[model samples]
Target: MRLGALGTSSIAWRRTLPTAVRVPEVDLVALAGRSADKAERFAAHFGCAAESGFDALLERPDVEAVYISLPTALHHEWAAKAIRAGKHVLVEKPVGVDAREARELCALAEEHDVVLRENFMFLHHPQHSFVRDLLEKGRLGTLSSFHAAFCIPPLPADDIRYASDMGGGALLDVGVYPLRAAGLLLGPGVRVAGATLRTRATDGLDLSGQALLVSPSGVLAHIAFGFEHAYASTYTLWGDRARVTVDRAFTPPPAYEPVVLLEEQGHQERFTLPAADQLGACLASFAAAVRAGGTDSAREGADLRHDTVAAMELVEAVRREAVRVTVDQ
Candidate 1:
């Protein structure tokens, strides 16, 4: 249960993740960052003293697990290193900016027989499963298509999400959500057919991007993400017999309780359950996987490969689509 944390900035370990996840009771052994003062402050806040820079923390004997909340660019490198250090890793989304890197990390983890879990806490959240249940149960019969959008206004200029060298973009950041939702609900093998990307003037990252995911089952998954416009976190599944939708699917999930809504034949149903504290739950799951001798779910080995490959493939596809439009014009 000893956990090492990298990049304590973005998610604000003190703010976003539950105290149950970061507290010393969970074996919060070390905090690593580029700044000594920041690390010290974080350690003081969490009531731990074994703090150091990233490389130094990796050298510690007590840190058996690592949670990486670093910028997108750093995730692959650090996660790979953590795996090499014989630590189970829980990495934030995208896993890598590309599939090859993701595959490499996965291989490295397997080479060591260490658990590697993607911190897609949203999927771990209950709402996603609840909605998927409705779809699987024929509540959305003869599924026609899926549509989702996740967007937020751009942050200040200092935001790492705007750094191209760090693999920042709407596609890498917010875009993955709707795409992940599609894969979860419609099955993997989601790919981009066509798309448009419009970037903000600040860093030329995708301020707004729209794309279509062609499901192999002949279903269309239309998805969008952006760094501007109103904030939205929602998904809709359109079917001949009914429709399913979810609100606030990605974040600040008040526990595992997922809110699910179903509409069929002019009748509607809404469901909400108390959420499991996912941050705590995810931490517990990783620790249990470690003690139990392997990854907790079958999805880790092969599903992770297919899922991340599909995600990266679509990211490239969308980027290429944007390029194609410029070339054609």
Candidate 2:
């Protein structure tokens, strides 16, 4: 499938565009930007043409799909427009700021008969499969709970994630990763048991937060995320007989061999998983879906759409449960 890029975001220039060009199933044809000069620079880097704007890229006959790496706030609007323009969409994570917006885009995709997928590329990683296999093999006895952490140091003052109008917050940014990790380890039907969101006095945007979630079958997950901390992206699952922990769970470099440790009693076992390019996997998978006429069953597009809404449901619950912190006057 011929694919076009819809933004010049860091993830797009650094990962998505680079990987998309390498995926055999995708022909990196065009890149769109608000400015012609910026688009031209990005397109040149990928050996593709530049379109002055998203509309121009959508109108191009060579572009069959769009990879949207725009801000969180613009995801719904641009994704909807691309779907309506008869192009498949691979949007960045948190397809929308809320469940309702995600549902609307899902419905629009169904109505337009196009595929719409959120690029939570970590889901495509093989390490996750290894973790699942351990669970399925009963290496980890009856599951009890899991804890995940995805924190990173603060960004520059002008970073888009701090922009309230642009749908910026710790809960929507890094928080979604741990939430998705919980669903992957526990189950999809996890519900937020409690949450707390905190913001800096200088800015009201949520800077850090944590959520307690429980799966339908009683599995528990503690998820925490923030933008002002030491870099950490890892999760651990505790079971009756054994516990499994994965380091570099999210944002592992493509060639990095991830470490997984399993502890039973006082004995520990370690495994080094093979290198996997999850971003490339995501591009290939989405390209296959587009080539297959966006069939719902060909890929888990339907379930993914459902999960988008489910994820936001937990996010909303967290927001409602957030306790505002203040200092005595």
Candidate 3:
């Protein structure tokens, strides 16, 4: 797929684009940014053309698809535009600010007959599949509950994550990881039972929060995330006969081996998994869908669309049910 990038965001520079260039199915055609110089720099680094604005990049006939690494608030707007232009879209995670926006984008993609996918690259990692296989094989016995956390130390005050108008907050930025993990591990029909969101008194942006969710089958999920804690990225699944913990649940570097610990009656074991490029895998999947075309493209995108909407709905539910608290800066 000949791909255009719609932003010069840090993630695009550091992770997405670098991995994208290594994917055999992807062709980096152009990059667009508000700043011409920055766009040029990124395009030069990636061996692609640079455009001064998004419209210019979209107008290029060589671009069959676009990867949007824009801010949370801009995802729906640009993604909708790209879909309307008859180009496949791969927007960064959280797909939109809320469920409503996600649904709208999905509908638009269907109407325009283009593929739309949210960039939840972690979902493509094999470690998750390995965990699922273990659960299916009864290694953990009857699943009862799940616990996940993806917290990080505070960022520089000037970071976009701290800007409210840009759809910045802990819930959208980091909390989504655990929430999505809950859905991935526990499956659909998971609903938030309770939630709490802590907002900074000065900016009214959320700083930290937690949620308790329950699956229809009585499986429980306790997820916590924040931007005001030590770096932690892990999740544990508790079952009747045993429990398994993933030490690096999210954001593992391409070359980093992941560790999964299993604890059983009077015994414990550690399993080390091979390093994998999840971003590269994700891009290849998107490229394959684009190449599929017609009915195949739509069929391939259906699950992704469902997952995107479902994840956004969970985020919306958390925000709605959260007991809001104000923390003094």
Among the numbered candidates, top lDDT falls to 3
Model 2: per-residue lDDT, tens digit, 60-129? 9888889998899999999999998999999999898998898899989988888889899899999999
Candidate 3 Cα lDDT to native: 0.91
Candidate 1 residue 277 C-alpha distance from true site, Å: 2.4
lDDT (0 to 1) per candidate: 0.76, 0.88, 0.91
| TM-score between candidate 3 and the true structure | 0.98
| Clashing pairs in model 2, backbone N/Cα/C closer than 3 A | none
Off by over 4 Å in 3: 294-300
lDDT of 3 at 298: 50
- Report how far residue 328 has shifted in candidate 2, in Å: 14
The full ranking of all candidates by lDDT, starting with the best, is 3, 2, 1
Q: Estimate each model's TM-score.
A: 0.91, 0.96, 0.98
lDDT of 1 by residue, 1-329 (tens): 77788877657465433453454346777788767888787777776654658888888998888888888888898998888888888788879888778778877877888888777767767667777787788877798899999999767877888788888877898998888888888896777888898865645667678898788898988888987758998889999988888887777545445667888896988887676655566666667777777543455555765676677777778888863222110
lDDT of 2: 0.88
